[model samples]
Target: MGRKKKKFILGIDLGGTKILMGLFDRKFGLKKTVKLEMDGNRGEKFFFNKLIDGIEEVLEETGSDLSDLVTIGIGCPGIIDIYTGTVKVSSNVSFFKNYPLAEKLKAKLRVPVFIENDANAALFGEQQFGAARGHGEVVGVFLGTGIGGALIINGHLYRGVSGGAGEIGQTFLSIPSVSDFETTRLKVGALVGRNAIASEAGFLLLRQKCPHLLEEIGYNVKKIRSGALSRAIRAGDTALEDLIRSRSRWLGVALANVVNVLNPELVLLGGGMMEAMGKIILPEVRSGIEACALKPLMKALKVVPSRLKDNAVILGASKMACEILKMTQK
Candidate 1:
């Protein structure tokens, strides 16, 4: 009898500071993974070259070639045109305006390519195999350096018209007493993002003349990352804990809006921020939702932390590649 040929998929996740490429089997289990730092300031060519190099490294490490892969899928952090595979605009990576990413990759690698918004890809991953498994309607909200969101409806990703529907971070709300003169509106991203946490903590520490947080992190505000903040909270930094709690309340408010509208069965949270502080933030988020969201919607909703963590987007992309390959085969 002839040996059964191996079928695999390649998945890439492009984020603000890093790129992850993985080789996956038919079941979306990772065979090999490669990580690369992304320097968005280095221009598009340099970044694209790094992506190609990472893909090649993973394939070589796994003893697989491009021919062994059915398709390649990329989860990009931007407004993506799924039909054209073009990145319209990326807030973190500014150089990717109207970039035909899939076409470029397909040309270089000679394989079918699929592109999707990174959050959407993560949601798809959860739906296929992670937290949202067995749920038809789901909402995924990832808290990291920035907040990102995605919607799943009736077993399919819901990228609304113009492919930019699930941008929950961009939700706006009025802020009171910014300078004691006038109210101001700000995006939820600015209020709850990791960088925002750092900035707000720094400002509060300096304003209130508290040095405990500075002492904990050796006086380096830049070191106030998600993990660092988690450690500080564990060590009884009341000021920092309060700050995180307030921000988490806002996160809950944002999520409540989503829940009230979509009323999905599940709200899966992922990303570094959630991984570090989900335990502290989730209950507060639930409280905020319960306070604001409609009773019926709130009753049916389940907010849970993602089990896949960092690999969610990559696996989701792999699943998407497999789906696209199936379509092509048909």
Candidate 2:
């Protein structure tokens, strides 16, 4: 059975520590947007209610109505079973082991709902309207609490056998250990995620006793956000900057492996961390890739920062809904 048409739509981007919601009209033009702080440990029910309330709040703010809303598209982290709209194993969201997120949200609002991996949604948005426009082969590496990735091949998103393709974060790489003769093998996500950097900053403070690290982060590792880290580096924290450069280099090496395998024409480095530290980090990453990737692949590859930044997911999600709406109409 086909669903009835409505005059508006909603898109949400759910991150580890932030929730961004955007309201769109029938034409997919953004009407209003609201951002709320998120804490995964607050439990499922509480967060669920918060989502509902936020949705209602946006409609009220814009003088819109729930009855006019058609579909909702949410982009969340982790493994999403797009076929069934289930979010499975989102490590960032502690409460979501495996949940039918789209079904539950649809039941509450009586609207069609769709869920996609956050990285996938962002890549789609970029491909259609942002950085990767007109690119047939692309790779998106998003650096946040974790490293999320998506791949585009032949102008399409490539979801693997289980709807989880282009996920480079889990790929294992060997890094040099403190002992010259040994190497450590670790997942890209675990090795270069924001938490990894935060931990490094904390360790830097303890070992080097850098006064600026304390002043910037104040002992709590979570406080060492991308902006703070960038500021500290700019303020003459050479050791910390070097550490971040090393991490970025590792990410570059990881990308090199990916490029050698996929030979994508474009590689985009993005997310909140990139937004804050792109100037300092992008070059290091490119240098790393240049150090490792094949000469032929490097010749045609374009490495750029994501133009939409954080807005990519919400916009992409909304665009997804609009596409569905258009399909149904035809």
Candidate 3:
């Protein structure tokens, strides 16, 4: 008998500001990666064209072609309908409202495609191959342009009713002061998301607190990403440090609320900010958790930074593609 031909899987991490794609062998070995910037402009056609071109570019570089692919998987931001592979509402992705991403990609690529909420895919990746390994229950929170969250219970990804079970970002930390006595609300995303952090930095800049940071991002608040902020903090921006600590306090309190309710085996803190400033922020977050989490639960619960860095979503997405392929074969 002749040796069987090899197949590959493609995993994409579609974020608000970037698109990352990885090609993996059948054994899940990462063969190549391609990165593309997404400023979230030029509309849907622009996004789709770049996506397809990026895929083709990666394959061409790896000495392979589309016919060698087994399946494709995507971990995208926002509320996703996993069954239909549609993105219901993506605030970070303005053009992805009710987007049939999987169906559209499948039609174009002529291959099986699966989609999952980015945070869910990231948590699954960590569980299978990264920090949360061997932990059957976990809560993962990602702080970025917006917050993303997911839950895993008994070694399985838990998507609650309507696939919105673990949207910790949407939870509220304060009551709004309505002008007319009507009800109002503010979500944790607005309170601690990256944009909020940048706004605080902007406030400091207006006050002339961190001039060094001013040179880094100029006057553009949008230019102050997590990495740049981290650099400023490291350069003795104690004022910026204090500001971040305050925001981390809010996140810590919210995480405490989540832990008090769910009490998972571990809590994972990730995303751009966490990736860059984990050491600076984790202490305050733990302090917040200590203030509110149940005493007994605290004794058993573990919280730590994610180990996979930027690769979690892609790895998880590719593994999901492998699983889907197995199911189809059966």
TM-score of each: 0.90, 0.92, 0.95
Give a tens-digit lDDT track for model 1, residues 93-123. Answer: 7788998988988999898999999999998
State each model's CA lDDT, in order: 0.84, 0.86, 0.87
Top candidate when judged by TM-score against the true structure? 3
In model 3, what are the clashing residue pairs, if there are any?
Answer: none
Q: Which lDDT tens digits does candidate 2 get at residues 13-56? A: 99888899999886768889999888888898889988988899
Worst 10 residues of 3 by lDDT: 176-185
Q: Local error of candidate 3 at 13, Å?
A: 0.5
| Model 3: lDDT to the true structure | 0.87
- Angstrom error of the Cα, residue 2, model 2: value is 19
Please give the lDDT score at residue 239 for candidate 3.
96
Candidate 1 ranges with C-alpha deviation above 4 Å: 1-6, 175-185, 205-220
- Which residue runs does candidate 3 get wrong by more than 4 Å? 1-4, 177-185
RMSD of each: 3.2, 3.6, 2.1
Candidate 1: which pairs clash?
A: none
